[model samples]
Target: MATNDNVYRLQGLSCMNCAAKFEKNIRAISTVEDAQVNFGALKLTVKGDATIAQLEKAGAFDGIKVLSENEPPPENTTPFWRKRESITTIISLFFIIAGYVLYFQLEPKSPFTIGTFALAIIIGGYDLFKVGLKNLVKLDFDMKTLMTIAIIGAAIIGEWGEGAIVVFLFALSEALESFSINKARKSIRTLINIAPRKAMIKRGNSVEELNVEDIRINDIMILKPGEKAAMDGEIIKGESSLNQATITGESIPVHKTFGDEVFAGTINQEGYLEVRVTKRVEDTTLSKIIHLVEEAQAERAPSQQFVDKFAKYYTPAIMAIALLVAILPPIVVGASWTEWIYLGLAVLVVGCPCALVISTPVAIVTAIGNAARNGILIKGGIHLEETGRLNAIAFDKTGTLTEGTPEVTDIVPTEPYSEADILSLAHAIEAYSQHPLASAIIKKAKLVEGKKVNAENFQSITGKGAKAVINGKEVYIGNSVLFEEIGSLPRESKQRISSLQAEGKTVMILGTSNEVYGIIAVADQIRKSSFSIIDQLFKLGIQKTIMLTGDNKTTAVAIGNQLGLSETRADLLPEDKLTTIKSLQQKYGKVAMVGDGVNDAPALASANVGIAMGGAGTDTALETANIALMADDLEKLPYTISLSRKALHVIKQNIAFSLGLKIIALLLVIPGWLTLWLAIIADVGATLLVVLNSMRLMRAGERSSIENNV
Candidate 1:
């Protein structure tokens, strides 16, 4: 059975009482199956099969804000004034029309003249005045403040109609700009709203409906058909198909059975499953995603920080310039006060920092959204900016460039044994051993249905191999060192081992008491996409691509050459890998490191930007990576790098465009050629244009498609 649900990442939320109050209103929705709130992470996880439209309608409840809805914003944030921007535009236009009508019809000496001007000021300047007063107290000297100053200044000089028209147009443009920026940030908020709130807990034979936060570890929860799983857990019983699109951005539903891991917020489809909770509600994958997203949003990119710091001084300096333009010109040239003040008002309007303040954030937000849609989660805008500047890329070879799983490829036997017999005997002797190489041999043996032998005395040698008395004969399965210790070694077997090792294969010696039985060659396979990724990186002007692995020199060189890597280092321990990365960083200035799992976590974290291959369920890789690929597809790395570069390019373009327009507008304002309305147009219009341009990153899929054709 399913229940009502409501979910949100509530900031600074504390106590179960707050959770209860939040749940009380959410549960009122008839379709809500369950509601849960985690005070620790300050997130509310809710689940129900209700459509997004239903949840949006339910979100209208008091004190409850749905950060996202089925439909996109202005419906999402749904501010009071935005729903009426068109109406406000019409009303402002009415005042403009009225002022023009009075200017043409009324005589200058008429008593109704004052009323007309007063009506113009009241109609056009009310909202501007309100905003100006609020900002004035906060000392936020923005374009709105400048517009307010210019409008009142115009009124003081008896240009009432000009003042009204200027404030009205400026307010309208500001509203539009605000609306567009909010729309640009819509994707980030949508990503944050993915986690569900309620879970179905199986309490004994009966199922009890509970909030996700109340879910304890090991509690068996039933994920109903078509609903999202509300917590991170293992499926202990039953079967189901799940759509993990929200979490991984994948479109297909993955089939799940007993002992399979299921993530929170993944859609359950086609069947029901009893999932035992493996993680606390606060520690679920969805919570981690939400936490990362929030951190990304709160963190500013380097370019953004630069712009912000620049504006802190830039705005006040512009104000000071406006002051000098007002007094210095009139004093030096003996110009009339009206003429210089008009120049000053123009300066103030032109000095507004709207474009400068908005340039970088818009690009950063767009890039982040673009990355997320492609199954790459960039932790913050800073990481995106840094990634775009990567001069070198270091790769962890084991799981990054090669499939870490090594398999037995070729087997050569000596003297009496055939290849099949050698493999069977080696598998038999090593069956009692638990080493990884031993398991690989055993698995290969099982593939051909090799007979299992009941060995008499099994002796395992530390750091070497295993020996056993099989069918009244002694057998040894180990490396060359073990065979040497036992006694005789054949020249042909040694030659075969050398040839295989030269070809980048691990040669394990299989022997009996005093004779060499065979040589089994095991090798790690290169990832199909690694070669293409290297070429793409080189094409993108990346200086070098290097491989670091714990494998021996032969294996590393072979894999590196096959993948076209510029350099390769082998026989490196974990600390050695760190030293190598640090040395490369010192030479290259900035580097990116990619790896598949946790063993490379330190190197991934130490690099300029850490990219982790996440599809393989490497928790450490996912947790430590600055950029995480949700799919095993390594081709996405090139796309991610391209996207970051494009985003950085767009940010530069925006910053240039904004600053260039501001300079030109400021120069024009000093000469009285630019008016308050024109300044507002330049300020808000440039901001809107840049914001729209930045949002083009969201269409990266289209770009990728075109690139694929090329």
Candidate 2:
């Protein structure tokens, strides 16, 4: 993240084991101090100085090509059948079929028949043997090393036809593994291609098409109906409905007008608009989402780390078992040496670590990519896994559960002062304040004509209210606590404040040091979607839905009852919210805290998972929270939890299925029933099934309406 100079992207990096070995080779270079390969992301980060040629040479065994992070990935224009891997497999298959015909038609020991089988083996296993033999010499025990030993040992035993067929099967399996990885990476590729490469910039008089990279901040972009935005900006003129499904996962077309922020890759519908660019192409929301998703892929899940550690020991143990199978049967039991050795070779083929090594990463990658496409940014696999197990969730009341836009609902005045007098005096003190309650009083004051009075020496009271000097008198505007401190409240005033507070409205007292002037009430409306979201959380097995707020207990309880919350903690400071999160974790196994990302920083950080709302175009929201919902609405909360649970389930299933199949195939060695091709088939079948299972995550969420229309 510091700079792109040392980070590079990789092509043809499909095997996790090969990636690990390649990283070590790069670090061995004298100029390189450290190297790490993120197999899930197919990226490499090298510390110290290293040339591209040097990095490429390190990965040459796997045919990996290194490209600068900024470079665009090359398009695959060649037909699949014409690609190098496919062509090699096809030619090898033809030779194997011809060899089979010659073995039956001519003598089994004929020179031509054996030559054809040897040609098949050489052609199909060139890359495999190249990497496998090098690993063999180093005393490494990867799948390739096991595979190389199996095929060569079979050839030395004079099983020419079996060796050639096994070679073709292994090559075909490798091709399928590559294809499946690419398929899982398609979501990331779609995100990269969402924004247009060119934009129409309004330069002085005439509009001209220009590349997005050439456009700068403050440039005016001309957008017409049915056009996608090329950069992030605010609309300066015109209005339209824009489909932002690709960015926020909201399928509906949201209406956008002057001053509304628009992100790149969103389609503008039914209006011509001019936008003032706010951010460069790389700084857009879509670009950040893409980068975060890639980084999430690189962060290994607990299951992935476990599998990687397990395979380190699992691979070497398989070799030991194979060696024992070959020696003990021939020496201890007096079985035929040729037949028992062949069985040992089959055991090596069955024990290839491909399926187990690939099982968890494929699932993690697919789930993270899918979550990004749905407008939910899951920061890493650890958070994704934690979300699935959350039993309790804490919510911040003001901006998260409520609309956050407070309005002036009621104003009461003493007998000496009129409504106009109260509005004017309160607006004078609150006008300079930036709080949401201040905005509401200011808005209501504008609608009613009030006395033109200005307050001097204004000061804001933290956690209480604001005060200023009006007509040489010290006036105060805050809650009952400030008023009670200055002067005793009359019984009527107390009753009136209590009534308003019970109605879920925030009551602010307006008075001077000696006598009370009146009471002003402001209320923030709850979001319409809040009730259903709470219900959905309950149905999803969330045990406790607690609300944390700084409001009075009366108001907090009033709002909590309406939303059916299980608990409410009112009059809480930022630190109190954090303590509550820790308490919830103690009571429940895991807890999630949802807030506006900035205000609830302490609580969000303390909770097991922090969810931020309205992440689109907001950099702080993206950076601060563990999970960010792009849209301002809470409709996606249930969907995110559902997807995470499904991902966890699939990851477990893939791991169990991969290891289970290998164990069953290893059992076949007891009866001497496993053949070279059959062992290869079992490994290939398990790998293919695991990949397909992980890909189910791509279709887990509902299809966006824009996709439906397309």
Candidate 3:
């Protein structure tokens, strides 16, 4: 279903030059106020009151037609025989065969030959003639006008056979271009169809089927084995191994428990499950991925802009040169009129600029679509291009390089108090704070389940830590700095803290004004895949991987060394992280900052490309990152960079191959080696090659074979 609105989704737009032409013409129509055509996105947005019939003429050359966003598709009304392009192709082919048969097999100079040839010219090239005549009368010279003039010149010179063949081949090329674009559009259509149309939801106690949109947030949905999850939710009952490749691009089936998260479009493999929907249908991660991918195609890259602007004048310049070729040699060196005219017509045929204009948009669109199919979502062409050039990457330790959940690893208490006694006191004071360390101490309290310490006068010391009075005694619980301020921290406690920090643990001091109680150690384990991912990045030609953290130098260095990081800047506040990101950008050409917390937002904004992990579950993931890896797996980072660089390489290759052929064709004009048919073939061949080269990016997911080197 589609809707008729200002934003019109389009299909069957194969030619970038023709799309540009449609944009220009549609804007000029009196019923239109504004028109914009995104060639890569294959969409046309217009503010107008024009009917479908009038708009169709604007897109007639490119075979583009608008589709509504929320209306059911109309049934086919035209018979297959009456389809305009097919009818013209069929009728033109009949006249072409008839003309050749009458001339060679029957009568050499028969009137039947001329009649059939004229019919072929009129039938196959009628649209070209009409557009060209309109443009000529309007004093506008474009590709259609260029070809029509060449066709008339050939006929006037009595080269009817070449002219007739030229019309037939050009029509066939247009049809082929249309078909190629439709083939590419099918990929996006498949993505749209991945989610199931209907979902089963429980209303009160009854399970009923409903449209996906009608299933609201917090609804209970039952997922049968081998069925796709209808919405993003948390499993409330049962267990299953779900294949989540559609959302995260992970090949393995992930096991889900009572509270584990699941996304729409992922299949439940083993057990039936009840899920509490966490997000509405439109707010699901799958929908956002599709929207971002479409928007990315609309954002033209710098190279694409340059090519499009160059094409605006490239054709007219060629027409001027062809005029000179037609008249100059005949006047200066007594060359034959028909011979020079023939060479000029060949030049005109080669100067359409279809291949040159398509060079960037097709590659950009194909690459964006390919990346979306995988887990890595590149937000736009600019970010995609920047990511491929990144030389260094900075990672925030918590929730990124390390598992974010911290645990109390060790507890050291002085002679007077037992381990349980110290933990109860620490938990009572830590419960007043909301920091990650506080959470770890509270969790330890629950595990050891002892008498609660009733503390009075709770006060937070900002970065130092919190303090509270326990059991009518002036008590303090914090780091060494907070305890040292009251002259209560024991000198021997420094040795114990240093030893624990060196083991990559955060040490917290629990003490009071008169005596020290103990030191509690907490540590967040580094991700098992972090070292391998860092190694892969280096193999992919990344020059540096750095860690920036607010943790002690001993702990930061411990983690950095294990991961083979180039540098570790420890004990950094949020502002320090921002400075490190800016400094990295200075030393390296481009730096990508990876982080998931609010503290990392500044650094992420300052970096060349901001990469967020576990975008599927975060509110800031989409807004704060240039690229979002839906799953938290660090391995996807290397794959993302490799895919971006591959796209860049293909884009460069397509542009080079297209322009190089045009240069060689233009050079052939000097020796008059270019013929009309050869020139047309070269243009069509170049276009097809550019399209085929861009399509190579469709295998981005399978390109993980390069991960060994990376």
Candidate 4:
């Protein structure tokens, strides 16, 4: 039994409705003393002796699921009808059909028509009456109150059919809204389920399977040829090609060898390896990604905040309007009471709020789905909307635009030795060292199949260089700083090193027996897609592209020029990059920062939209950024921006079309030109039209010919 303060993360939440249902259902369990769900946070907090497993079973309700029990419940509450939405929908439809049949097929004023009207009232209007009465006591005039008043006023004036239609259409629209929200939240649930439940651990040349939580750091884990690594670790032996699509969204497999890092939840495609766990279950990359995603979902965007504020006032104000329509129109025009009451009912049906409530969510869901299909995962609707409006983009140079790994591209020798000879001797000394630049030289030398010359009395100097006896001769492999400490640099070698440095290459000098032999220049390669992505951004209406990098100015400018960027800042640490992003935002109004490494976390969080490159397995990037690009391919950036813009455009069209139609209908209602059937058609027809329009976002790839263009 855990203490009263214990908290657990709950998974399998499909929507706010599911969260609410789980919370309500869990309260019925005896050991569950109390449970509160923070739907906004996607967590459930429980204070009781109930174990996680017990709480999970107890919290399961119809259409509701409980995930891990270690965290508090989410804050979002369930909708009223989710538990029995299907039943309510069926009942509402039946009443609508019966009412229409009885009114049209039977004689006017028939007993069947009256009975049908009564059934409609009970089926559709009962919930509205109960909600209105409850809210009326709290002085909270909700949408239900507006609806109840309109229906009752119609019944009072002998317009029972009109009242029935209003409630029926409203009920149907609410059900649809609930369903759409559930669909929007399904992606999060799917992502949470990807974490592995168990791990294969190697113990004393034997293997045993255990729960993921029971595995510890530094444990030797054996990953078979086709198994997913269950935790983050380094390959201690063997080699494999891993399909990292689950993490990076890249369809291609990445080759991994000794000393390379492997993440849990990524499938190993070929070969087998023994890995030394570098991270525990809780700290694994997959866990961090899950944790970060949950947090990002809870964060409200500025536009969503506006919607929340509008909902608070919009419901009450509409109720007052319905009352005015019901009472004042009859008094002003000397119209029959029933006619004015029917006009009030029209207003209630028009103000169902289906359009307003779903406007943002529909666009959000469509945008997220579209983005995901194109290898980008936008954490929330807010990010999609905000990113679409960005005026400028800031990028981290290394890893984002250029491959971070340095490679030896050019080697120049002085008087006594050729390039191959210099490389061979240098590789002999560097093979014993683990420095990045040293590794690059050694890798290149190995490509040439150079002889491995053993060194005697090898000594490494921290941050300076290395000295060793190679072939009974003293060999020094390091920078000019190390040589300056011993003797003056040779004229030819000094000139070559200076030239390479000016060309933005890191120069490493190799010397033998007090004479400088040769120089190797290493540089990071530009990603093949970077230039094209920058060009695509221009076509997408982005006004500026800026590069922020820790690399030196020469290298940064070379890459920036290749991409035709307008601004470039080099030699920036992580904090400096963040400052640069802030300054750009202050100048340009809105800026998006994109990077692919853990160091980019702060800047990614601070930007108007933080976009992570190759984010599939990088948890910090995925969680911190508003959007994550799963593939290393940068071409998707423009596609994502286009999708978001199109989604927002669709939302605007729906809102305008729905509102315009409603206003025109209200005007006609007062003049007696619009009847009960017309009001119902207008309400349902407009809702369906908006829904179809929102669905256009799903087909944006086809509509815009994005695939063909790409």
User: Please, what are the lDDT tens digits per residue for candidate 2 over residues 1-710?
Assistant: 34333889888775877788899899899988888887766778888789999998998888889998867567465766687988999999999999999999998779999899999999999888987898889987788888899999988998889999888988887887777677667778888889999999997898899999899999999999999999999999999999999989988999999999999999999999999999998899999998888888889889988998898788779888988888898899899999988989998998898988889888888888878888999999999999988899899998889988998889999989988999999999988899889899989999999888899999999988989999998889998888887775888999999999899998998888878888899998899999999997787778899999998788889999999999999999999999989999999979999998888989988899999999998787899889999998788887877777778888898988888888888888888888888888888878888888887777856644212311
Off by over 4 Å in 1: 1-82, 94-125, 134-140, 160-162, 414-416, 615-619, 669-672, 700-710
| Residues forming the 10-long window of minimal summed lDDT in candidate 3 | 69-78
Identify the runs in model 3 with alpha carbons over 4 angstroms from their true place. Answer: 1-5, 29-31, 48-54, 60-63, 71-140, 160-176, 217-219, 233-241, 255-262, 270-280, 408-435, 438-478, 482-493, 509-520, 571-576, 705-710
lDDT of 4: 0.72
Give me the candidate number with maximum lDDT.
2
* Candidate 1 residue-wise lDDT at 21: 47
Among the numbered candidates, top TM-score falls to 2
By lDDT rank, best first, the candidates go 2, 3, 1, 4
Q: Rate the local accuracy (lDDT) of all candidates.
A: 0.73, 0.87, 0.81, 0.72
Better of 1 and 3 by TM-score: 1
lDDT for each residue of candidate 1 in 532-561, tens digit (9 for 90 to 100): 889988877689999999989987887788
Clash number for every model? Answer: 14, 0, 7, 26
Error of 2 at 62 (Å): 2.2
Query: Could you list the CA RMSD of all candidates, in the order they appear?
Result: 8.6, 4.7, 5.0, 5.9
lDDT (Cα, 0-100) at 462 in candidate 1: 91
Model 3 error, position 137 (Å): 5.3
